[model samples]
Target: MNAYRAKPLRYPWPPVLYAAAMLAAVSLGRLAPISVAQSQGLIPWLAGGALIVVAVSLDIWAMKTLIERQTAVLPHRCSSHLVTCGPFRYTRNPTYLGYTIMMVGFGLIMLNPWFFILASASVALTTAFAIRNEELHLLSRFGFEFERYCRATSRWI
Candidate 1:
């Protein structure tokens, strides 16, 4: 799908959907026991912080590369270049991966098992929608070169 030709909600809805779920969990989820919450302490905070940092950095890195490469970031826009450098070498969809990791990190921070459930839903939505559509678009646009990239990189790490 050429990104410019695609509508907003049709292409990038995961972030909004995840945010809604996160908000719902925060407001409606049963808080874990005080003991449980307390015990899930510094480590979770540290780890979650680390994951968020990584996630944001990966997104920055990938977006920078895409911009430098003169490639379109929008799913329905024309892709002028296929970026294989930086984080793209590792994951086909670093932006999507970043969002997934962010969900996990947010879950860790919240200490609510429901947040983890939200993260799982995030992953499932990401896979079923974002990645699937992007993969098909990339494959159709880039053809064999995209296939080689796919062969070399995992979808997510």
Candidate 2:
């Protein structure tokens, strides 16, 4: 094998599926025990929304810190420099973590357990795919440096 596989389909189906699952869970939860509406009208929603924003912003920060400076996949070849600092210190894929967190936060805000579960699944799947791609690229580009970094950092934190 080439250390990495071909890129999978880029459709947003995974995220969509997660969203659906979350909605279903939340709806069921609300129906079974207590509805979020009865508890607090707009409070949890606002908090959840804020959490989502924060999570997305963190991902953006990770993107800026790691990928933005190193690689240029837009114009031509996928030439990305190895990024191993800041958020990368804790987790190999902070951007993906942030993405997952953001989705999970949204699900929580909706008071939908299903959404949260879906978000979690999406994270797991995305991580599996992204790590494979990233590690291969890193191994090819940075060689020992990337491998060393990978050894040091956890994949998710």
Candidate 3:
């Protein structure tokens, strides 16, 4: 799995693709004949924003558990742990899970199908990329331990 090992990513592709899809969905929704009420401005937005924050907190907690479990820990960007506890036991990437939940919350706040679609796309793409990169790193680092974890826990929940 050396070929798939995590390395410097092609930066803009992931961000650009995700942004473009999100924007396009939003643009289409706006252009189409839909009577969207502009009145729902603050409350829903606040609620959704709160949800996003909670998700992020959960992610932080999960990551912390992984950090505690790993022999050598690093910062977020350089984390080398193959965490399989906490929320990670349910979904391989709780960080991504937080992002997904946040996106959904944002969609609810926006009350726009476009935002929802974008959130979905973002989750799907991020999950694919994360799994690929993380798998390679885990295979290289933890070997059988990582494999056992993978067998026990799902990639996503």
With a 3 Å backbone cut-off (N, CA, C), the pairs that clash in candidate 1 are 2-76, 2-77, 3-75, 3-76, 3-77, 4-76, 4-77
TM-score on alpha carbons, each prediction: 0.83, 0.68, 0.67
Which has the better lDDT: candidate 2, or candidate 3?
A: 3
CA shift at 8, candidate 2, in angstroms?
9.7
Candidate 1 residue runs with Cα over 4 Å from true position? 1-9, 30-37
lDDT of 2: 0.63
Q: Rank the candidates by lDDT, best first.
A: 1, 3, 2
The model with the greater TM-score, 1 or 3, is: 1
Please give the lDDT score for candidate 3: 0.65
Please give the RMSD of candidate 1 to the true structure.
3.2
Decoy 3 TM-score against native? 0.67
Over 4 Å off, model 2 = 1-43, 72-77
Tens-place lDDT per residue, model 3, 1-157, is 3643443233424445555665666687779624556655588788788988987897788757876887222221334666776777787666666666766676667676666767777778765765566566667767898889888887767
Model 2's number of clashes is 5
TM-score, model 1 to reference = 0.83
